[model samples]
Target: MLPVFTTPPPLGSGDEIAVVAPSRPIEESKLQRACDRLRETFSLDPVIFETATKDWEWLRDNPEARAEDIMRAFEDPAVRGVVAVTGGDDQLRVLKHLDPDRLTSSPTRFYGFSDNDNLRLFLWKHGIVSYGAVLHPTVTVDPELHPYTERYLRRAFFEESLGVVEPSPEWADEWFDFETGDPREWRENDGRTWRGEETVTGRVWGGCFSIVKWHLQTERYLPDPGDLDGAVLALETSEDVPLPREVRYTLRAMGERGLLGRFSGVVVGRPQTHSPGLEWNPGDDYREQLRDEICAALDEYNPDATAVFDVEFGHCSPIAPLPLGAKVTLDPTVRRIRFQ
Candidate 1:
């Protein structure tokens, strides 16, 4: 049976949103722009936590400090929501310091992705609904927030529920150094593809593929397989750009854990085939090849599950934040997805 989660309160015009950094160090200038937009455009107040603007070394060495910021955010009734400044690789270290009861007591909407997925999942384990990372970064985009992003951000923040899940008109996979002031390029979105005939309705779970896999590996803060029954499993790769086979290995591990077979459907985001430092090239049909591997693993562990690929969500420009722990319907017959 799917677990029922307590939905956090919606944001009001003057509501306060806590800006925190649980993992990576951040640039104050970029963060200020995001905070400004939250105040001016979203009509919300943004309060930056002490840990958010700390230098890289300080953030790296101070897990307890990062955890303190998180505790303060949730404990403050004035702050209606909590969002990460950005994601990093070391958030696993910070999780140990969080007190589940104290965090869950307020049940404020928490948002993040990549490493921040760590906190989202932790909140999920306590039966509290939180959002995938989309709000903060979208506010800081160079030219402006894409309408697709704006539409979803509005729904996720102030509205009762994120309505329909749709593809962006255009998407970008590369990142530019914020100091350079160059805009990230956008290309026509190919949209999502369906691979099953059946329609399924289920609450959403899963986030960055690596974060989910790490939880399974460490058996840390993971929900019971029984709790995930009838869930729409949402998974995506980050800029780390794991090879196609590595994705399969993680999927296989989930299958072995008796976890993969419980989902009613799976949604995969577009994989970042190339990054600045990565050696991968797009000519190798990396996307298609990765699709095949995912299909193969699903066939082995979850043959009955519906699978959809290339639905933008994580590590991509113009993302639609998944309202984790909320119900969504995926109809492959017409190739449509709607969040309820």
Candidate 2:
């Protein structure tokens, strides 16, 4: 039997949350703003670790320091949780230096997505449940936190068990310039759609599809393929917004590795179809095409597996957190998801 992961105790108001950079250093202004939000909005004390504001050159050269900061934050009893400043491309380099013992020993809530997928997988391997959600920088600089984002954040941090996963009333397709500190904008969400039948209950696994490809290539920090049997796969694209063909090929690669068929179900986050320089607006039609492609890939490899599309966790705004390595029930018949 697979070992059961211990859920970290939830944080309350006034607790100190450590802010660290396991990826690239965040801009100083954005870092400070995030710290302010943690203090003023959440009523949590934010402890900024040194690596969060280091120069890009130093961050690139000091993977060990980045890993050490993570370990130190976990080892420190005073810190109730750890939050990543932002996701970056180089976090995979830091994984080699992290000690799994330090992570399992304390077992506190750790939150971040995209590049932090590396750390999430590391923690998952050690039987610790980490969160896939928005980073500190994005939350801090927003003029007002999206109610959807705040609601889920509160549930993740304060509740022992999540009730139901609901679609956000609205979602943002456009990217925000955090350096400019502008308020975010959003469009209406039609709601979630399912591609398979029946209910599937399993522990959640996987994150940014591109990051999963990186881990697959490196053969580093990934759970044993057998270990993921009966797990639910959660996947999303990043801001770079990989094309439908790229998405298909990545899932194909997983299928080729004998990895795709092990899952009982799959939950795909809303794709960020828009990028800075992309000309055409990829509206509902394009999203449906991407979903069809993903469904096709699943059909090719794991025809029996159930899949849900456009769930609210990913590069999009007003995101919710999904607990890595935690039990979740996906009922496609009712189009409902519940985190246990």
* Overall lDDT per candidate, in order of appearance: 0.83, 0.84
* Cα lDDT tens digits for candidate 1, 283-305: 54777988999999999999999
Q: Which stretches of candidate 1 lie over 4 Å from their true place?
A: 1-3, 134-136, 177-180, 282-284
* lDDT at 152, model 2: 86
Q: Give Cα distance to truth, residue 269, candidate 2, Å.
A: 0.5
The C-alpha local distance difference test score for the whole of candidate 1 amounts to 0.83
- List candidate 2 stretches off by more than 4 Å: 177-184, 278-284
Which ten-residue region of model 1 has the weakest summed lDDT?
133-142
For candidate 1, report its TM-score.
0.95
Error (Å) of candidate 1 at residue 45 is 0.7
Best by lDDT: 2
- lDDT (tens digit, per residue) of candidate 2 on 85-196: 8888989899889888888888899989999988898788888888876455348535777788888888887788666989989887766666676866767889888977
TM-score of each: 0.95, 0.95
